[model samples]
Target chain A: MGGGKRRRKLNAERSGRIAALPSAAPAEEPQAVTVADAAPDAPKPVPRSPYEGLPARAFWRSGVTEQHPLRVADLYRKKFALSPSHQIATAGSCFAQHIARRLKGAGYSIVDREPAPLGFDAADAQLYGYGLYSARYGNIYTARQLLQLAREAFREFEPAVPVWRKGERFFDALRPSVEPEGLASAEEVTAHRAAHLKHVRGMLKQADVIIFTFGLTETWEHRASGTVYPTAPGTIAGRYDPAVFAFRNLTHSEVLADFLAFRKRVREVNPTVKFLLTVSPVPLTATASGEHVLPATIYSKSVLRGVAGELYHRFDDVDYFPSYEMVAGHPSRGFFYEPNMRAVANAGVDVVMRAFFEAHGIEAAPRAAAEPRPKGDREGGGRRKGGGKRSKDDVVCEEMLLEAFAK
Target chain B: MRLCFIGNSHIVMVKSAWDEFAKSHADLEGEFFAASGSKMNGLELRGRSLVSDNPSVVDQLKATSGGRTSIDVDRYDGFVLVGLNLGLVNVLRVGQDHRTVATVGKAPFGHLCSDGAFDLAVKRQFDAASSRRIAEMIRSVDQKVPIAAVPTPHASRGITGRSNQFWADAELLSARAEQPWREQLEDFIRACGVAFVEQREETLDGRYFTERRFSVGSVRLRGMTERVEEEFRHMNADYGALVLQDVMPHFGSAA
Candidate 1:
């Protein structure tokens, strides 16, 4: 008990000494405390030094300073302007789909990388959307899986059995099809698959800029084969072998290596292809990690962020976009994602796109007030007349006007 | 404070509200868990596998608490669990359908009926039951945390044609209606021991629907450009603002 008491006293004394170190120098030099305090209640007989005013300025500076600025809008505009001439390839998370969609809508040349038949009826397309690519129909969850897919596709390894009918053909199956009135013939399906693969390779060879969204570092893999399935095999259609299947939490180094390999492969296909990478801001709805859900989100996001940082530092062509930071790390609570999980706020997208444009000196087109909504009508209402209401538009506009006037 | 959430989209709205409200008040910190298309019976952990195939959520929880075993139950001041009709009704459907049909191995689960539509309905119910079971399991793991169950939303305007049937019979089935779901979800949550914040009826102030154009992802989901100036309009007047106001006062304050 005496020893414990002594230890506590020592700790208190040490803490006091640590705290007194900064003040001691000022005390000896007769520093101004009132100005130093800077509080509204502090004495105001004398004006603070110019350097003293810097704390508030420094605080504001800290808030806005960026380690790197990869303008997303500039990239979008450059990609869009070059779209007519260059075939743009997009792969990665759902956000990648957005880039592709925007490019396609703007009448640019976009390679069809998705396996599903595009351009089907809205209802039928929604159903097919659930089954495209792999089960979960989404891209591989980890960078390792993405690299593996690119490698496998490049190698053209024949499977034990063809996953689909070899000679099937489907209209626009290789591209986004708007109509889904009927099922494609077996021959059409096969033809479309082959055409799709060829198109993907061609796009990789010709792409001026490849936009990839690295989603999560957590993945489930086949232990024996190292095959990374998009979803757990059973969740979609593939067979799950417990003996060969294991979950992996990809490390920063592993993710960096995969990106390096992935970049090399892209260059091998098209040496001029620049890579733009972004982390998806969407949080996982659930996790199998048997831990509290919130912490799992942080763990996955942090690892991905680390990987992005490492890759950005190592390669000059590789740039990072702040989509994840813009939404998930926005000054305000993110109001982008829909309640039903179907759509993200268009306004949020607009903000990031605007930032991208401003940095690149590209004139941004006015966002359509009646921007289309997603399936399930998650946004509640349809559209607004005149202009839709946004909580921050006025503040943003005011700030912009002030900056312009100051300039 | 320890808080739990129930229902689907309605619960999500509440979460969004709380998220925004909490940002302004530094004194309060809280967490919310909401499952889309989830039901009450799905919360149960016993007699079934509750382990999610998606490891993100569990991994998040583990990381937040430092480790799996170190989940600080005492730090939570309250718990809220939202329960809607979908979970309960679906659990009942699973039992009823399991005995009535013998589709052999044709159906993956024994509870599904032979007809396609009926089978889809059954599948929907089972999904809800599973969600409830999961919720219950979460509660079981942390008994000290309070739980709240919310009901599904009711049909309002905007839903037309065959889709209207889903919302008409709220007691029988929890349709995809946002309003009814919010109301029932709030009631159930209160019953489950957490303080309730109601929003459905209050959310619909004075807005009405009209045709308009709207986009999703890169695809245009609704493009009625010729007929209407706006793609869609609020069916209620004040829109969802009232619910936000009602819940704002309770935020960061004691239950």
Candidate 2:
């Protein structure tokens, strides 16, 4: 709380100083009547370039070009440190699952309102989308989706079609993957969603820190109700009808406004909650926009990254974690990606988490013991040399189905 | 009807009780195939026989089943799988950190989980039990023979004075919460094509603890000697007789 207020004051002072400076460049002609003419006896200020005295991290040559990707230090600095006791709630794209998993493994007080019950297979629980977030709302790819979820959870708004029927089973349109097999009937879906929302509401009201990873800008929404779905209707469940469901690529202002609204709604019940935002580094599986996939991904990521930067500068409580830059920035030279060049490698996640933990002054929990390796592969342990087979693409990305339609 | 009782150490009670039942009913015949705790897990379906490669399990099979190291399962009219860790205690352990709608008011410290999720979790736990695995193995070899699973009995009521942290943690459980776990277990076993023979209702003190008389003087599997008074999980011959009574009806004319 104090951090945001302090940063705002510093920013105001900096702006005032900038405003007091000379607005235009001086003429090349020799000025006989200089500062010396007005104050002949006064001391003259020394000439210096605007970039003088800036830290090494400010320059590309020293910050990235000359340094090893893994050794590029000071990539992240916490605006406010997280206490061991803080109740941290996490939600976002599939990439955010890495953050939630790491936070949980590191012994942070990660708030899990709707945890998978005991004795369930850990892998099956993950498949069912439990323990993947603070609540089992599946992926919150767009800010609009996040805002819609908060509204729905708090009973302020209801989606036009809450249940999507696929064959004989019904799925909660908001989070189709959370119940992978779907429910027996629409009534069952409604009951599950009601139970889920109660926990989501509690998670939002009580959390001290909420970390969100902005994933995608392209979303499918109900034309009438403006309800943004996590994935396209037909991707997970429900038939994709052009008239009923409209595809929209969100602009910068819309993403910012959606997050702002989400923050405001949560703060209404929890005034002290802080937000940690990041941009998911994994590229979009397929873009609905007419542009090429590469350019579309850049546009989506750029919008999210810009929003995070603006939010960081505007609010002290809204810190930005550069997981995006750590994994996908030029310094890494695409080294952290798998062979497919989309899913992040295990090593990439390690580098991001190392920086995150170091910034918070916390020691990261050691990784779980690796299984016994084959004779020739014992050297690298977890991640092999280069982005080899060990870069497990384990995340559940429903958007990947769009790629199946490519051919 | 000739019956084959397959299980771990918990089968001792049922085996001794079956001997008593056979005296009055000359038409009924039964044989027990047992091993130490979890050694029954080593029993594999080899062709038409259920056999074990582990020498200790092989020795146990011989000692318990009248020198027969392998069972020709088709010879038996029905099979009862006894205690391979499917029971109320394991279900109660899950309540340490999660409560369903049935348990929310009773459990003050756990997260409130949905009843459906909690039931699925309980079903998975029961499904994972070695008893269910053995039942499935039997059914795979013989699809038509009647098969039933008898879960381990509830702890003795004498546990009230104990300082075991596990039992203390289970204090959050009530009969209402336990009902779902029971129903889930039965449903899961039935789904696996095995009948679930529940613990005798009269033998239970509460829903999850057996009456002390049924648990007292329980015998060990290695010998027919009585277990020490501190034993809380093993059931005595009287308790086993009730279990047999529950299992018989599932085999139709066997009752």
Clashing residue pairs found in predicted model 2: A4-A316
Please give the CA lDDT of all the candidate structures: 0.44, 0.76
| A1-407: candidate 2 lDDT, tens digit per residue | 59999899779868775444443322222223345445766776443434443566766666677678896876688998898799999888755677777777788989888777777755556655677789888778889999999998899999988889889888999988666667777876887788889999999998999999998899999999898887688866799999999999999999999999999999999999999999989887777898988999999999999999999999988999999999888778899988878877778888888889888888986654531111110001122222123212344456445654455
Top candidate, metric lDDT: 2
Best candidate per TM-score, number? 2
Q: Where in model 1 is the C-alpha error above 4 Å?
A: A1-86, A103-109, A113-140, A156-193, A340-343, A365-407, B1-255
DockQ by candidate, in order: 0.01, 0.27
**lDDT tens per residue, model 2, B1-255:** 888998887897798688787787687788889888778878889998898899999999899988999988888998888888767665665666666544544334445555556666766765667777777778788888888889888887777556644455354464534666667666766656888877778987866678889878888786757675677778888888888788888877444
* Consecutive 10-residue window with the lowest summed lDDT within model 1 chain A: A375-384
DockQ of candidate 2 (2 decimals): 0.27
